[model samples]
Target chain A: MRYKVTIAYDGTDFAGFQMQPNERTVEGVLTKIVNKIAKNPGKRIQIFGSGRTDAGVHALGQVVHFDMNTQMNEDNMLHALNSMMPLDMSVKKVEIVSEDFHARFTTHGKRYMYRLSLGEFVDPFKRRYTGHWKFPIDIKLIKAAIKDLEGTHDFSSFVAAGSTVKSNVRTIYEASVRFDDATQEIVFEFYGNGFLYNMVRIMVAVLIEIGSKRRPVDDIPRLFQVLDRNEARGTAPASGLYLKKVYY
Target chain B: MRYKVTIAYDGTDFAGFQMQPNERTVEGVLTKIVNKIAKNPGKRIQIFGSGRTDAGVHALGQVVHFDMNTQMNEDNMLHALNSMMPLDMSVKKVEIVSEDFHARFTTHGKRYMYRLSLGEFVDPFKRRYTGHWKFPIDIKLIKAAIKDLEGTHDFSSFVAAGSTVKSNVRTIYEASVRFDDATQEIVFEFYGNGFLYNMVRIMVAVLIEIGSKRRPVDDIPRLFQVLDRNEARGTAPASGLYLKKVYY
Candidate 1:
């Protein structure tokens, strides 16, 4: 039987999403618990996530799927899994699904949000979750640049170095930057069919640079023509990135 | 010159607000930085807080006063003190005030906010800042009880055991509970001329019990007459309490 699970995690302590030999990764912990629940059903159960999240990245609705032979119901599985999981991670929901429904391959689109704290001093409570950018930013320039990022385009310049993907073409259905008055936070939300390795972070860095007037607002549209990674600014930190939602 | 400073701190790592012989405290850290900035002006400077906050209690606008023999202006002092203070503590403002001004004695009232996360799954990001209460609550009962807590009353029943204050009488100016639908959090805000030791926490505990139907709704006003500390519910955890503001 196949099961789909929605999970949320604070990635501050995890190495990343993928399983590594010795490091504490989200996948490593999930796999440990899933197999333990199988309880010698003769085969180790394996879980697959919607996508990999980098270290220090958070997730609000990350979806995953796995196969298990146990007769445990969804409620019992959720209770048992959450009871043994660490404090930083939790299983929000679990449901039985058709075997054909794959968590990764059957995905349609995803949404990611990057949070920037614009205050003079970093908020101690939000230090672990938000990227602190104390420099002044021109909100008008950022709004203009966000408009250029929407639509289907080959985001080669925004791809991180060492990414071996053969295709850099991805569709960004929506992109916008909004300032939260109460918290003095700048939030960048991106919705797209897919994203390249560190693509969102790199795009955020360029937007911030443009917002700060360090780079011309026209540079965003110009970078698409260059198709060179060096033409883009540095990638933003992973702490600000959140896997907001996954669609299937 | 005497300086009055507005401060904010994440108390997750501090023992409390007061300086102890060996504990890591907000006052201990602030005093160290102030003295270092003083640079052997001859006497070791001491800091006086508006009041002591218990361990794991956060503060958003705590006021403190101290004397220093330094020529540095407010801007430079703010920069120097913040640069040297630990990541968990920060000085929001520094102003030279009259020597007659006192942080504790000049006070007229204070406002406290206690956050409760009533969801089945606690938000991982807010886990450190809010208290998780998973039990179902009756909002109507809580609202009625909140109204009963306002106004002047002898809150001897709400004081913590071993508190040495001569008078447990305090005036609650405003008390209310508002539910935030977006975060599914219940925030209890209290404004009072003064709060007895653990008074707000105990009040919250009894309110929660009433909300959960574990205790009768009239128990709030009834406890005021009993004047017995043992009559109240257990004190709420310190993690959920925040010294929101101190007024003078």
Candidate 2:
């Protein structure tokens, strides 16, 4: 039986969503727990994530798919999965899914949020959850820059190196920047058809550069035209990025 | 110069505030950094904290004091200390305090905040920052129970089992319970002369019991009269507690 699970993780302690040798990772732990429940070597199965998140990146509504030897009720599955979860991760929901429903292939769009702190220094309690930006930011500049990010665009400039994918073009359905009063930090949200490797973090860095007046507000389109990663200042720290959602 | 440093830390990965062999701790890290800055074996000095927080507990304004071999400007001191701080901790402020101003010995109150999440299941992202209470909580009952907590009292019932302190008597200047709308969590704040080992967590447990209708609304006074730790339901998880401030 195949099942879909929605999981959330603190991500501060995780190496990433992918598994690695001798490292504590979200996928590694989850795989261990789910397989442990199967209790038989023959019933062992592999789990699939919507996408990979880099080391130190977080997620709220990350979805995953897996198959078990026998069908189980959702509540029992949720209880079984969540009860064994570590303090930093939880399987929030579980549901039976079609055998053909793939976690990665079905993803049509994604939403990501990046948080940057404006404090003169990094707040200790927020160190794991926010990326610090010491420079003064003009919200108006970022807001103006965000207008150029809406709709379809070639985001080659934002994609990080080490890409094996052929296409750098993606459609951003929504792009927004705002100050989160409660957290006292700047929040940037991007919803796009698909994001390339480190795309969100790179875009966040470019927007921060615009917000700090290091670049013109209308420079995003020019970067697309240049099709060069060097035009982007730097990738924002992974600590502040959250995979908010993956819409199928 | 004797310097008073206000520090904040996310204690999720710490063994506790006090140092222990082969364990990561807040005090150990601070002492190491401070002594590193002293730069002379002969000038090595001990660091003292206002109080200790248990493993997984957090702090926003915890204060400490240490004497240095030489006087240093506050900005440079702040920068020097903070730059070397681990990701989970930060030195928020440094001041050249009077020789007599001891962090733990100064006669004043302290402020603590306990965060309890009302979610049916633990939110993984908040696992390090909030305690989960699955039961439905009545804010009014908890609020009423909070009133009995204000002012001076012999809080023997709230003290943990292993406390060796001779006096359980302490003055609570103020106590209040409020719902934080932004996080959808119940926040309990206490200002007092001092707190015993695990006192705040025990009181929080008792109050939560009251909110959940397991005890009388005015049971706090009776718990004080009982002078027994068993009277409290259970200690809340350390993750929910934060040492908000140490008043000198």
Candidate 3:
């Protein structure tokens, strides 16, 4: 039987999602704990994920599926795994799913949130989880900047140059910028069919630059039309981005 | 001239309060930053605190004072020192006080807060600032245990052994416990004339053990009366405690 697990992680201490030989990775840790709980200590389990989140990139709805022959109930397995897992990661929800259910292909839409702490002092408590930008940014300018990117468009300007997507089109259902005074965090939320490699980060960079008055808000549309990666601003750090939700 | 400063810090990365050679100490960082900001770089500044905070112990109002050259304006020095200091250590307030104002001697009351995450899974985001305790604890029992220590008494039973306190008799102003569900944190707030070494941690240890039903809530008063260090519960981790305020 296969089980689908929804997990959340801090991602500060991890190298990335993929399992490396020696470095600490989220997938590697999850696999190890899953194997240990299944009573197959050395068995290689093929864990499938919805997507690969970069190093220092966090996730709340990171869906994964794995098959096992163990008889341990989901509650027991969850408790056992949580006890062995480091404090940086936690299994939020776990359930039995159809053996044919694919975590990657079955997803419908996903939301990503990029958080930037804009204050005099970067919150030391949240230094690892948030990106700090010291410049004063205009909220109105950022709100107007991302408006042009709301509809379907060729998003080559937002995608990383190393992205392997044959088609660069993505339809954003919603996009907005808001500031939280309590947390002193500026959040960018985007709902899309999917995101390109580093797409959210690149878009965030453009929005921040626009908010800082370094770039015109109206120029965002023209930059996308040009389809030149050099025309876009630099990509934001991975720590600021989080996979917030996925609707299947 | 001397300046009184109120300090706040995230203690996860610090070794301890006192300055040490070739180590990352809170006092060491403050000294270095002050030297960098002051004109007299050769002057070894004295940072007098109410007391020493152990490694991994945080503070919101750890009071300190230092004498500097008369040429340095109090406000300018405060701002300059904070600017040059790291993100973790912050100067919350600074004032030019009476020459007799000593951080340790003039202090009248002090408050400490202990934060505990009493859930099955500790949030990855709050791992550094919170102490995770998965075992279920009874708040009523904990409150009853605290009630037994709400007045002036010899806290030798609660204070760690070999603590260099000249006297064990300290007056406690208030001792209370509250839980916040949204943050999943149990906060223990205590105000006293002063504290012995590891006193709050040891008190929290006894309270937590009582709350967990491992020890009886009524046993707390007997421990205080007995004045035996080994009769009480073990000391809680230092990471859970914070110097919340120091009053003068």
- The best candidate by TM-score is 2
RMSD of each: 2.3, 2.0, 2.5
* Tens-digit lDDT string for candidate 2 (A1-248): 88999998988789999999999888999899999998895956798999899899999989999999776799999999988988788877898988889999999999999988887778877778888899888999999988798888788898989987899889999999899887789999999899999998998888888988899888998998999999886999998999999898
Poorly placed runs, candidate 2 (over 4 Å): A40-43, A69-71
Model 1 residue A233 lDDT score: 63
Quote each prediction's TM-score: 0.93, 0.94, 0.91
DockQ, Cα level, model 3: 0.59
Q: In CAPRI terms, where does candidate 2 land?
A: medium
DockQ ranking of the models: 2, 3, 1
| Candidate with more favorable, higher TM-score: 1 or 2 | 2
Question: Which one wins by lDDT: 2 or 3?
Answer: 2
lDDT of 3 by residue, B1-248 (tens): 78888888888889989888887998888877766666674757768888889899998889888887766676787678778768788787788887999999998999999999877887777777777788989898998779787889998888876787688998889999988776768999999998888889988988899999999879977987899999885988877889999999
TM-score rank, highest first? 2, 1, 3
Overlapping backbone residue pairs in candidate 3 total 0
Clashing pairs in 3: none
